[model samples]
Target: IEGGLLASPPPHQYEFARLNLTYVITSKRKLAQLVYDHKVNGWDDPRIPTIVGLRRRGYTPEALQLFAERIGVTKSDSWIDYSTLEGCLREDLELKAHRGMAVLNPVKLVMTNWDEVMGVGHLEPCSQPALPHAPHGASSDAAPEGTEPPPARHFTIGKEVWIDREDFEEVPPKGYKRLFPGNKVRLKGGYVIECTGCTKDANGLITEVLATVVPDTKSGTPGSETVKVKAAITWVGVANGVNAEVRLYDRLFLDAQPDAGGKDFIESLNPNSLKVITAKVEPSLANALPGQNFQFERHGYFVADRVDHVQGRNPVFNLAVGLKDSWGK
Candidate 1:
C-alpha cells in the first residue's frame, strides 16, 4: 500500500492454497535444521523434499507435471501419499531410461567350464538393447527407424562375472529361483549355467561360486530359445565391467505422518536411508554422462551424479528409486 493502492495484488484477492504431501514438510526452518543438525547429508540430499534435492535424485519434469495433474488444484488442505509421486516417476522412466546391469554387494561366480569351451582367458562378446522403449530417433544414442539398428553396443565377458551376493543362499526359502548347489539359472544375455558348488574360506564365508556352462545355451544362439530356466540373473564381467560408487536411497522417515500425533518428527528418521557401496557395473556405464538415467536391470532406476560424475573418472550413481512397489505408506 505504498500510495494507498496495493501494487502487487489485484483489486479482488484470491484464496490461498496448501500442498500437504505425506512424509514431507515444506518448512525452510525445519529443512535448515536437518542440514545443521547433521540429520541429512545436505540441502540437496535425495531424502529432502526441495526442488534441488528432487533434481539431484533424478526426478523428471514430466513426472512432476503428471503428479500435479493427478492431484489437481485443491482448495482445502490435502495429503497426497508419497507413492503417488513415485508412481508417476516409474511411469515416466519405464519408457525413457536405458537398461544396464550393476551388482551391489557383489559375489564372484567362476565359470568352471569356460576354459574348456571358450579357451583360457577368452572374452566372449555380448550385447543388449540400447533403449528398448525409446521411440524412433528419440535419443541421440538411438538408431533411425527402419535402419538396421547399429550393431548393438558390444561388451566382453571372461571366465568370471560378478553377481549380487544376496542372489544366493545356502538354504533357500520356498520358491527360491536364484543360484544354489545343483540349481540351473541363466546368466542374463550370456549363458545358462548349473551351479556345481561354492568355495568358502575358513570363516565359512563364500568366496567364489562355481558353475558349469550348459553347452549351446548362449542367448540368441540356435538352441538358446528352447532352453528354459527358473531364473535369469544379471552379471558384470570382471574383465569388462567397471567399478562405481553407488548410493542407495530409501525413505527418510519411518512414519507415514512423522509430524502427526504430537510425536517428534526427527524420531521417525530411518537409520538406513542411505547406503554406499562399490558396485560392479557394465563397461558402458563408465561412460555415462552426468544426468544420464538408466534402469539397473532387476534392481532399480539410477542416474549418474550430476555434480560428481565425470567420464574416465570414478563415476557416482544415485539410486533414483527401486523397481519394487511402494516404499510403504
Candidate 2:
C-alpha cells in the first residue's frame, strides 16, 4: 500500500520557543485506518493527536507554544506525561481568555424575594471585567500601556437563574459552602443570596432552589455587600442565558503507552472521550466569534467551534482543558 499521507497537515514552521523542540510522531497510515473505519470522525476529530485535531479541539497557538517550550527537544526517545501538555494550555489561557458563566448540568434557582427587593419582573444589570487579570499586568492579550481597560461583560440578573446542578444539595456534606438550606453564598459578580428552601419533584429530585437576594449587592460585589459569604457560585440568568451545545473532551487513550511492543492501540481507546451536553451560557457569549476562547468561570476553558458554532444562534464549544489536571488521581 502506498503511503496515503495526503491527509496529514502540510509541513509548516511551528515558530515556538526560540530553542529547538521535538514533538510526538504519529503514524499516518494508522490514523487513516481509524478514520476510514469510522472509529474516529475524521482527521479533524478532537480525539486525534494532530494539528488539525488540536485546533478543532480549541488548542490555541499560544497554548501550543507554551507546551513546546515546556517540553524541550530531547535527543533520545522519551515519554512525556499528558498532564504537562494540559497544564500548558491552562496556564496560557488563564492569562488571556475572557471570563463567562456556563452551567453544564443546570437546575432552576429562584430568587423568591427578587420582586420584593428589585421590583417585579425587573432584571438588574450587572457587569464584570472582561479580563479580570488585566489590572494585575498578567493579561497576555491586553492592549497598549496607555490604552483603556478592556471592555467589561454586561449581563442582567432576573428573578430566576441557572446554577450548576452540583452547586446545590439538600443534604450538605461536612463543609459544603454552596446552596443548602439557610446557607449564604455570593453569586459571583451578582449578589449575596441566602438559601431559604427548595422545591422538589415527585421523585425527590430538587427542581428549584429558593433564595433571598440581598439589596445593594448587585455588581461591586464583596465591597458593596454587607453580607459576607465563604463561597461564590457561578450562575447564568435564565431570562437571557443562551442555550448552547458544549462538548466535553477527555484523553483518548486509557493506557499511557498504547500500541507499544506490537500492542493493539484500538483496545485502549477511551470510550468516554467526548460527551455532548446542552449548557446555559451567558448572553455575552452569544456574540462570541468562532475560534474565540473563554473561561467558563467555575468550568474550564472552552472555545467556540469554528465549523459548528453560529453567533447568536446555535453555539458550539469544545473543552480545551480543565481548570486543573485531575488525571490518575
Candidate 3:
C-alpha cells in the first residue's frame, strides 16, 4: 500500500489511475459483513462515525475549521499520534460548550436531610452560561451589533440526584475517594456530602445510598466554601432531567496497526467497541436538535446524532471522545 501511494508518474497515467483506484483495497466487505451479521447497525452507524459523520453528529463548524488550520496541509503521511488529534478537539471544545451535569451510569443518592432543608419543589437550577467568553463582533455599530444572546441554562438543584454507579465501593480501593462508608466527597458544581450508608438489593446490588448534604456548602452560594477532597463526583437532577440514548464508541480495531499484518482486517475489530445506554441529561439538552455538541460534565464530549435526533422524539447522542486526561498514550 505504501509503495502504491508513493508510486508517482507511472509508465501510463491511465494505468496508474486505474491501479491507484482499483488495486487499493478497502474493508468495505468486512464492514458489510458486520452489518449483515447484525453486529453493527449500518454504514452510518453512530459507533463507526467517520469525519463527515462526526460533522453530521453535531461537531461545531468552528471546531472543524480550527482543526483544519491546526493540521495544516502537510503532504507527508507520517504516523500522527492520536493525542495530537484529541488535543485539537479538546482545544476546540474547551470554549464552545455550556457546563451541565449528567449521570451516565446512575446510582441513587439520597440525602438523609432531604426533607429538612431542601423541601419538595425546592429545585434550584444549576448551569454555567457565562462560558469562556461572551459573543461579540459586528459589521457596523448600528447593525444591532451583536444580537441578543441566548438564554442562560439552568439545572434543577435538590437533595437527590443520580450519580455514577462506579463512584462507590463496599470497601475503599487504594486511591478511591468517591463513596465509602464514613467517607466524604464533594459533589462537583453542587455541595459537599458525607456517605452515611447504602442499601443493597436482594442480589447485593446497591439500590440506594444515604448521605447528608452539608448546609454550608451549596456551590456558589454565600456560605458555599471549598474543602480539600481527593475526588469530586458529578450528578443530575432527577425531576428536571431529560432521558437520552447515549452511544459510547471506541476505536474500531483493538490492534492499532491492524492493516500492518497481511491478514483479514476483520479479525482486528474490537468486540466491545460500542455500548448504548439510556442516560439522564440536563434539561437544557433535551430540546437540542441534531448536531448539537455537549460536554456531559464528567462523562465526555458528545453530540446529538444527526440521523436519529428528533426534537420531540427520543434524543440520540454519540460520544465524540473521553476526557482530555486519557490522551498522549
Candidate 4:
C-alpha cells in the first residue's frame, strides 16, 4: 500500500520462496527418517539413485546421462512414467556391458568320464575373447557422443562347471528348459551337454548331475553344431573358477508409491528383495577392484561391493539388476 515509502527489499521475500519448495514430498526430513529407521540406509545405499549409489548398482555413466536427457530439463512435478527410465537404461546396456557366466544356486556337475575323456585336473582354457570389443572410433561406427566406452574384460571361462540348482527338476514343469533326467540344454558360452543322470541324497535333494558334453558343438569353432533346445544354462569352472558370495538385491519396496497409503514405509518392504549366497565367478574376476561392473550373463549386472568385496579372500558382489523388464510395476 505504501510503494513509494518501501526504500529497501523486504526481508521476508526469500522466506516466502522457501515455503513453496518446502511442501515437496521428497523433503530432506522425510528421507532422513527413512534412513534412520533403516527403511533405507544413507542416501548412497545401492537402492537409491544418487550418483554413488547408481555407480555401485552397476549403472554405466552413459546410462545416467541418457536418462537425464530423455526426461528433459524441466521444473514441473508431474510423474514421468517408469518405462522412460527402462528404455534409456536398456539402450546403454546393450553395448556397455559384457557377458560372464555365473550360477546363483549351484547344482554339482560330476563328469563320470573325467578320467577317460580328459584326465582330472587337466584344465582347459575356457574363455570368451569376443567380448570387451573395442568401441567404434571417430571415423568408424558405434560410438555415442559424450559417452566413454566400456572397459575391456579379461575374464576366463571353462568346462565342468556348476549349474544353478533351480535349473534341474526331477519332475518337469510345463515350460522348463534346463537339466531334468534324460533332458538336454546347452551350457551357455560353453557347449551342449545332455543330462543323462543325477544323484540325490536321502532327503531327495539332488547331490550332483552327470552330463556328457556334446563332442562337436563348441561355439564359434568351424565344426560347431547348434542343438535344438529351448534352454541354455550357465556355469562356472570348478578347477579354476573363483568362489565368491553374490548378493542379489531387488527393489526395496513392493509398491511403486512406497510412501503412499498412509502406511509406514517399512511396511511395504519386500522380504525377498535380497538373497546372499556363496557362488562361483570367473577366475579373472578375482582381481576386480571395488565397484567394477559386469553383467553376470544370464543372471544380472553386478558390481564389486565397496564395503564387503575382498579381492582375494572372499569376494562379494551385489546383483544390480536382471537383464529383463521387471521394475516399477
Best by TM-score: 1
Tens digits of per-residue lDDT, candidate 3, 1-329, equal 35696555555543211111111123566556766877666666644434555575445666667755765554444344444555566667765555566788888898888678677557756655524344343222222335554466677668678888888887878988798888888887677888998999899989998888877776678857655567788887777777889888766666555555476656777787778899887777777778777777777788888888887567888887777646327
Query: What do the candidate models score in CA lDDT, each in turn?
Result: 0.85, 0.83, 0.69, 0.67
Superposition error at 261 for model 1 (Å): 5.7
TM-score of each: 0.89, 0.88, 0.77, 0.78
What does each candidate score in C-alpha RMSD? Answer: 3.6, 7.3, 7.2, 5.3
Candidate maximizing lDDT: 1
Which tens-of-lDDT digit does each residue in 1-329 have in candidate 1? 67777676647856746777777666788789899999997988888998879988989999999999998875776778888888899888987688888998899999998999989889989988766655543764565567654334568777899999888877778899999888999998899998888899999999998999887888888879677788999999999789899999888888877776667889888998899989999978888888888899999899899888887688899999878665653
Indicate whether candidate 2 or candidate 4 has the larger lDDT. Answer: 2
Worst 10 residues of 3 by lDDT: 15-24
Candidates 1 and 2: which is better by TM-score?
Answer: 1
Ranking of models by TM-score: 1, 2, 4, 3
* Model 2 C-alpha lDDT per residue in residues 1-329, reported as the tens digit of each score: 24876555656664432321112226787778788998888889887778889888888788888887878875555677777877888888876788899999999999998999889999988888778776457464566568876688889999999999899988899989899989999898888899998998899988999999988876574556577788999999999999999999887778777766677878888888889999999988888999898999977999999889999888999998889877667
Clashing pairs in 1: none
Off by over 4 Å in 4: 1-25, 73-76, 81-83, 130-160, 226-231, 261-263, 327-329
Shift in Å, residue 132, candidate 1: 2.2
Clashing pairs in 4: 126-157
Question: What is the Å distance of residue 113 in model 3 from its true position?
Answer: 1.6
